[model samples]
Target chain A: MTAVATACPPAVRQGGGPVPVVSEGPALLAGIAQGPGLAAHLNRLGPAPRPSLGALVDMARDVDLRGRGGAGFPFATKLSAAARRRAVVVVNASEGEPGSHKDAALISCAPHVVLDGAAAVARALRTQEVHIVVSSEHPSLRRVVEKALRERVTAGECLDLRLHDAAPRFVAGQAQAVLQLLAGRENLPVTAWQPEAVSGHRGRPTLLSNAETFAQIGHLVRVGSAGYAAHGTAGEPGTTLVTLRGDGWAPEVREVAHGTPLADLLDEAETSRPLLLGGYHGTWLRPAQLRGMTVSRSAIAAAGATLGAGVMLPLAQGRCPLVRTAELVEYLAGQSARRCGPCLNGLPAMAEAVRALVHGEGSVRRVEELCGLVVRRGACAHPDGTARLVASMMQRFPAEVQAHSVGTCRRGREVSG
Target chain B: MSEHQLRVDWPACKGHGLCAELLPEVISLDEWGYPIVHEPVKGEVLAMARRAVKACPTLALRLTLPA
Candidate 1:
């Protein structure tokens, strides 16, 4: 109902912000491994065309643009909700998932694209302010973004860019958490729901998106919607940026066309081991199941998995996956904000159950019960996402679970507690 | 007559279980002893919801009967 928003003063405007890792599509990651300098970004993408607010929304809808922050929520819908009300752009670069590094990759390699999109949103909304939130842990990334902002200012672009360092924790990247951190409060999500578009950013409508979502917007502005739609399937336009890891190799960022075969991006012949899609909050699929799967939201959903913040880990064949999953659950449990009972209490209980099962100390039924108890119970999707990871691992690898229960891991693998 | 709604401030609710006892039709306790809102507290169930809200020791249960 209100289109007026006051910009909050920059808090430690040097380098800190939200932690959502980006799944920047190929377009966003254009000129791979290139310098994040303003001149390089300008040379690569050319000048971004200014579009009316209405035109921007239509562009997003035309290409079926979805947030690459992992939820895949249609970007157009969020744009429309905050269209006329107000705008303060918050970019999530936190990479909350421990395994994800795509957002940081973009910040390090292409900071301009993220800012270009963030500034465009502010310019469209007439707010003229944008905030890029990166993890406090990444000092070099902070320097990179700081350098990018300085370059933009030096180039005579009159945009207000504020950088704030935030706690480098999983939930710290949630939009609500970002807002809270910016407010200098404890970084925890509120229980009651006011859509950020309704009352975000100090109680004014704000456009909140991951760094990659803004990268997509930046590309959309550079190329009209059609040009942007040139890549990927008609259903899911644009390429996808995926962070590929596992097998003890250093994590790498790969950009591929939407719906590109999962087999293509990953070395399928690496091992016959099952792969985990969608990071820690994602599901595990057998190699056979992952064979024909594609990277688009619809295809990933069809494969009974999510491209969760674009992390794919194909485990090393010799590692006991059950033990690995147990460790992950324990980590997730510790990451809980601890405001909701189900998440706060249930996660540790679930972790205990999974740990027990791994050590031949308990039954899978307890794990299943804990999973059921936790879903749809927390204030945020953290608990539900955690449950999904646990439930899927149990369903996907019954043989592994069975072996763990019998105090043995798969043949040739030692069960480590 | 407009519908009534029930919500729990999860962080505030101490899993006292009184809400489940009073408003059994709309509330149930999970294994962790947390109250889960299972149904809408409208129609005849509104009265039960009100009792639960009043009896809530932590004063965390909220019943939003339309004004």
Candidate 2:
């Protein structure tokens, strides 16, 4: 019922903040390299690295690349277990996270790069099949990627690159659910006793990754580990794309080096308050603590948070974190596929609790207990992430929650921090 | 080992309290009129869960197995 200001923040505020990565410079926008510049530059035009399983593993190791997806699973580790004969490669473009569009932007602006990565993985695994699952909302983008795959096929890339339209649900993008859909099963989470990665997609070993991860692989292949490592930190090398949005913040994609300090990024974005790092599933950190804070997963983890798909939103002193958290929780709860126990049950429970607190009807202690219960009981990370997001907000905005509890907070008024 | 679970269609759910009314032990009605089915009944209780599912006026509740 509230129509708060959703306008993007200023492009450049005089003495306000540092420029966002998306706007700091022109997007380098590198496509899949056909020839060699660094790494094992092997494509049609480039000397094809004779598809050795060990070589592919070594290549991934050299770059120290991890899944660009939210989980940050190791790419080399995922590839090592996926050498089965019926191995399949899945390019996940479902990208259902709200206020997050980096994957779509990557696919739309540079489809070939993602295709090259998919093709390389298929070639590396000696598999004959590759599938790209995109959201139905982005039909044109899926078309462009499919066309790029066809063009590559004509150029002698001998692999079956299939395009699949994912069901328009948030959890449909989940690894297991996506696999179920790909296998022509119900478009819901699997009920398998075994892990989906090892026994997925018609009882075959499937390698599913975000669209950005595959493109990063293609980039790593061409740039070489050392070259890719040049800009990022020692642990996680390469640039990461982040979606920055909020009041007094322009909504745009930004490419920051893996170890870019959080303070610098916020300064560039011209945010004038404490920031919410990661996505709705991420954490809230003091702005002063952001000083000299690195943006890598390890660093974020060390700081008691995870840079989930690189969604950074800065809440100035006025925007009520309690209200914002409640709104976000409601949105996330609305997006659940409702296939699991905790997510289907706990999220709505938690959302209601938070809503009651925001509307001055509940206690924070009850909300905390609910948060503790919901974190680890889901089939996917939705419940856990939602819990973490809401829990962090509750911790960070105790004052707001207290005010709401005391029935003094005027939630109807247009309030900003 | 089969596990019992609750499933919901978030967009389709209008926060009706019917599911909680049908199965009070597992599902609780929240302030927003949404049912919070905390514990999903598997095996024997699944029948009761299914009955509750059938009783949902909004048709939002379902019994499911874990993935």
lDDT by residue (tens digit), candidate 1, B1-67: 6777677777677888999998888788987789878776677787777888999998888876543
Summed backbone clashes in each candidate are 11, 14
TM-score, predicted candidate 1 vs. hidden true structure: 0.89
Chain B TM-scores per candidate, in order, are 0.87, 0.82
lDDT (CA) per prediction = 0.78, 0.69
Q: Tell me the tens digit of each residue's lDDT in model 1 across A1-417.
A: 111111111112122333332233457766644456788777776777768788888888899888988888888899878765557778889767766777777777777888888877777777867888898766677887898899999988787788887687788888888888878898776564567876788888878888989988887888887888788888888877777782136456666778787767677564267888888888988777876778878777877888878888888656677777888899999999998888899999999998998888779899998998888776677888889989988998898788878788775565655
Predicted candidate 2 versus true structure: per-residue lDDT over A1-417, tens digit per residue: 111112211123223433222332112243222111222223322532334678777888887777877888878889988887889999998876655666766665556667767877888888978998887655566666666676677777788888888776667787877887887876666444455458767888888899988877766666666777877777777788777772234556666787877666556433446677777778887655576778788777877888878777887446667777888889888887775555677788889998888878887888887887666545567788888888787777677677777766644443323
Worst 10 residues of 1 chain A by lDDT: A1-10
Top model number, lDDT: 1
State residue A73's C-alpha deviation in candidate 2, in Å: 0.8
Chain B in candidate 2 has what TM-score? 0.82
